[model samples]
Target chain A: EAGVVQSPRYKIIEKKQPVAFWCNPISGHNTLYWYRQNLGQGPELLIRYENEEAVDDSQLPKDRFSAERLKGVDSTLKIQPAELGDSAVYLCASSLDLGRNTEAFFGQGTRLTVV
Target chain B: SQQGEEDPQALSIQEGENATMNCSYKTSINNLQWYRQNSGRGLVHLILIRSNEREKHSGRLRVTLDTSKKSSSLLITASRAADTASYFCATDSNTPLVFGKGTRLSVIA
Candidate 1:
């Protein structure tokens, strides 16, 4: 089976411009997550989706960052008027379901460079 | 915000040597997991140890969880050059898995 898939492996955009990243979780996976990993740092949770419902998105910057999981399979994360600090890797992951013992599968991630 | 914190931000060892990484988390967790990420690639699951379990091994990888100390350790024996990567520890408690700043391991051949 194919793993979680993410598009635009690398993206470069000017500051103040808008950029979007897309993710398609593994087939039959009910739980998906979006994470941001800055250089030299671990991935941080940006949002999480259980099917089509976004159950945890408190960490997402509402002013500039927005995400949606339409149809409960593919997810999109958007950054409007991007800032230089927004340059990082945006990762998507999925699991069979949300639980304590299950492991997550990750995508290659989209490396966004805000210049 | 991140919960788990990995010790020894970086490590360097010769091939065939053993590599050990430690992680400490704040809150209680139902399970702890270790992941490896090669440069410019995605994170891959290495192993998972449940709270009720103390030790588990997979191939050359050994994972031990200590719920009382809220810490875990990952041991990779007979490391190879291919083992060079960033290792991260994650915790789950019915919530989205939270990761720690990873420990970069360099296994020189």
Candidate 2:
């Protein structure tokens, strides 16, 4: 089975511009997650979806960051008026379920560079 | 706040030697998982050890979890150059998995 798939392996945009990243979870996966990883740091959870509902998104910056998962299969994370600090690798992951034993598989994250 | 923290930010070892990385988390967790990521790529799941369990093994990788101490350790035996990557430990606590600042392992051939 294919792992989580993300589009635009790398993206470069100027500050104050809007940017969006896309993700397609693995088939039959019921849980999806978006995470941001900065240089020399671990990934921080941005949002999580259980099916079409965003069950957890407290860490998401509501002011400029928004995310949506339509039909519970694909997801999109958008950042409006991006800032230089917004540059990082956005990773999308999926798991069969939210069960404790399930393992999440990640995509080749979209690295964003805000100039 | 990040839940997990890995020790020895970086490690360098020769092939055929053993590599050990440690991780500690703050709160209770259902399970802990280890993942490896090559530079500029996504993370690959390596192993998952449930809370009730103390030890789990996969091929050359051995994971030990200590719920009492909220810590875990990963041991890679007979390492190879291909094993050079950043290894992260994630704690799943009913919410999304929270990762640690991974340990970068460099296996020299």
Candidate 3:
């Protein structure tokens, strides 16, 4: 089966502009996650979805960052009025279910550069 | 704040040698997983060890978890150049997985 898929592997935009990233998880997967990774650092969870419901999104920056999983099969992460500090890799991951033991598979990620 | 921390931020070794990476975490965890990420790529799951499990192996990869010490170690035997990548350890409790800074391993051929 194909792994998780993400579009626009690389994106460059000016500060104060808006950017969006898309993710398509593996078939039959019921859980999806969005994470951000700064250079030389590990990924930090921004939001998590179990089906169409966002179970955890406390880490997301409400002022500029927004995410949605309308159909529960795919997701979109958007950042409006992007700032210079918002430049980082946005990673999307999925798992078979919300089970604690299930392993999550990740996409290639979209590298967003804000200048 | 990050819950886990990996030691020896970077390592370099020749092919056919063994590579070992260690991870230490604060707070209790239900399970710990190891993942490998090539430069500019997404992470790939390597192995997962439960809190009650001591050791598990998958082909050339071996993982050991010590819940009492709140630490885990990954061993790759007879390493090859293809094994060069950043290895991250993630700890999961009742919440989402928390990752460490990761260790970058370079297996020179």
Candidate 4:
């Protein structure tokens, strides 16, 4: 079985430009997540979805960041008018559910560089 | 706010030696999991220890959790160069799993 997959392993864009990242989760997984990791910090959850419903997304920056999981199998994270501070690795993961015992599979991540 | 933090930001050890990394979290957790990341690649799940459990072993990896201390430790015995990577501990609750800063381990051959 294939693991979680992400597009554009690396991305570079100028500030104020819009950028988007895509993710395709493992088959049969019921939960998906978007996380941002800075240079020396751990990943911070940006949003989480169970099927077509976004169960958690309080950490997402509503002003510039938006995410959607139309069918719940694939997700897209978008940042409009990106800022330098938006540069980081965006990781996507999936699990059977949000259960504590479920192990999440991660993608290589899309590293974004905003100049 | 982040919930977990790993200690000893970096560690260097020789092959065949033992490497231990620690993690502490602020709130109650249903389970704690350890993951390893090589270079800039995705993370691989190493082990998971449930709150009802205190210890778990997977090959050369061992994880111990203390709910009262709100801490967990990962021990890699007889480490090899292949073990060189960043180790992160994630705490799971009803909320999303929160990861720690991670401990970078370098195993010299």
Candidate 5:
């Protein structure tokens, strides 16, 4: 089966501009996740979805960051008026079922560069 | 806040040597997983150990979990130059999966 897919392997935008990343989870997967990884650091969970319901998103910055997993298959993460600090890799992952006790399949990720 | 923290932020070893990495979390978890990431690439799942389990081996990879100490260790035997990458430990709970800062391993050929 095809693994998780993400669009725009790399993106470059000026600071204060809006940017969005897209993700398509694996087939039959019931869980999706969005994470941000900075240089020399591990990925930080931005949001998680159990189908259409966002089960965990407390770490998301509500002021500028927004995410939506429509139809429980594809997801989009948007950052409005992004800052220079927003430059990083945005990763999407998926699992077969249940949130815990499962290994996640990851996408190539979209590397965003905010100047 | 419930994220795992990996010890020895970075490690360098010669090819054919063994490299071990550790991860410690603050809370209980349903399972712990190890992932590897190449430079500027996505991550690949290595292995997972459930809370009720203690050790698991996959090829050259060996994982050990100690719930009593809330820590896990990953051992890679006969390391190769291709093993130069970052290794991360993720803890699973009722909350979202959170990854540790990761340990960069550089294996010299």
Candidate 6:
């Protein structure tokens, strides 16, 4: 099977500009996740989706970040009015199920650079 | 705040040497997973050890999870330069996986 796929491997935008990243999870996977990784740091979970519904998004920056998985297969993460601090890698991952033991598959993240 | 913390911010070793990294978490976790990230790329899942599993071996990789100490260790024997990457430990909570600051390992051939 194909691995998870993401679009626009790299993105650059000015401060206050808007940017978006897309991800297509593995086939038949029921769980998707978006994460942010600052330079030299581990990824931080931004949101998680079980099917089309977001099961966890408490860490998402509500003021400018929004995500959706309308069809439960692909997901999009958006950042509006991007800030300098927003420069980081945006990663998307998926797992077969939301159970405690399933392994997640990741895509080659979108590296967002805000100037 | 992150639930897991990995030791040795960076490590460099010659190829064929054994590499070991440690991780400690704050809360109880259902399972612990290890991931590898190449430069300028996304993460790849390496291994997962449930809280109930004490040790597991896959090829040259060995993982040990100590629930009582809230810690885990990953050992790669006879490592090769291809194994150079950032290694991260993640905690599987009820929600998403909580990750720790990774250990950057460089294997010199």
**TM-score for all models, in order of appearance:** 0.98, 0.98, 0.98, 0.98, 0.97, 0.98
What DockQ does candidate 6 have relative to the true complex? 0.79
- Which stretches of candidate 4 lie above 4 Å from their native place? none
Model 4: lDDT of residue B24: 95
Tens-digit lDDT string for candidate 2 (B4-96): 999989999999999999999999999999999999999999999999999999999999999999999999999999999999999999675
Candidate 2 per-residue lDDT, tens place, A1-115, comes to 7789999899999999999999999999989999999999999999999999999899999999999999989999999989999999999999988836888999999999999
List model 5 lDDT by residue over B4-41, tens digit each: 99989999999999999999999889999999999999
Over B1-109, each residue of candidate 6 has an lDDT whose tens digit, in order, gives: 5888999889999999999999999888999999999999889889999988999998999999999999999999999999999999999876557999999999999
DockQ ranking, best first: 1, 2, 4, 6, 5, 3
Task: List, for all models, the DockQ compared with the true complex.
Answer: 0.86, 0.83, 0.74, 0.80, 0.75, 0.79
After superposing candidate 2 on the true structure, give the runs of residues whose Cα lies further than 4 Å from its correct spot. none
User: Per-prediction count of colliding residue pairs?
Assistant: 0, 0, 0, 0, 0, 0
Model 1 C-alpha lDDT per residue in residues B1-93, reported as the tens digit of each score:
888999989999999999999999999998999999999999999998999999999999999999999999999999999999999999997
**Candidate 3 runs further than 4 Å off:** none
User: Across all candidates, what is each one's fraction of true contacts kept?
Assistant: 0.90, 0.85, 0.67, 0.77, 0.81, 0.79
Candidate 6 ranges with C-alpha deviation above 4 Å: none
Name the lDDT value of residue A56 in candidate 2.
89
Worst 10 residues of 2 chain A by lDDT: A96-105
Q: Give a tens-digit lDDT track for model 5, residues A23-42.
A: 99999998999999999999
Give the TM-score, chain B only, in order for the candidates: 0.97, 0.98, 0.97, 0.97, 0.97, 0.97
User: What TM-score does model 3 score on chain A?
Assistant: 0.98
The segments of candidate 1 whose C-alpha lies over 4 angstroms from its true place after superposition are none
lDDT of 1 by residue, A13-57 (tens): 999999999999999999999999999999999999999999999
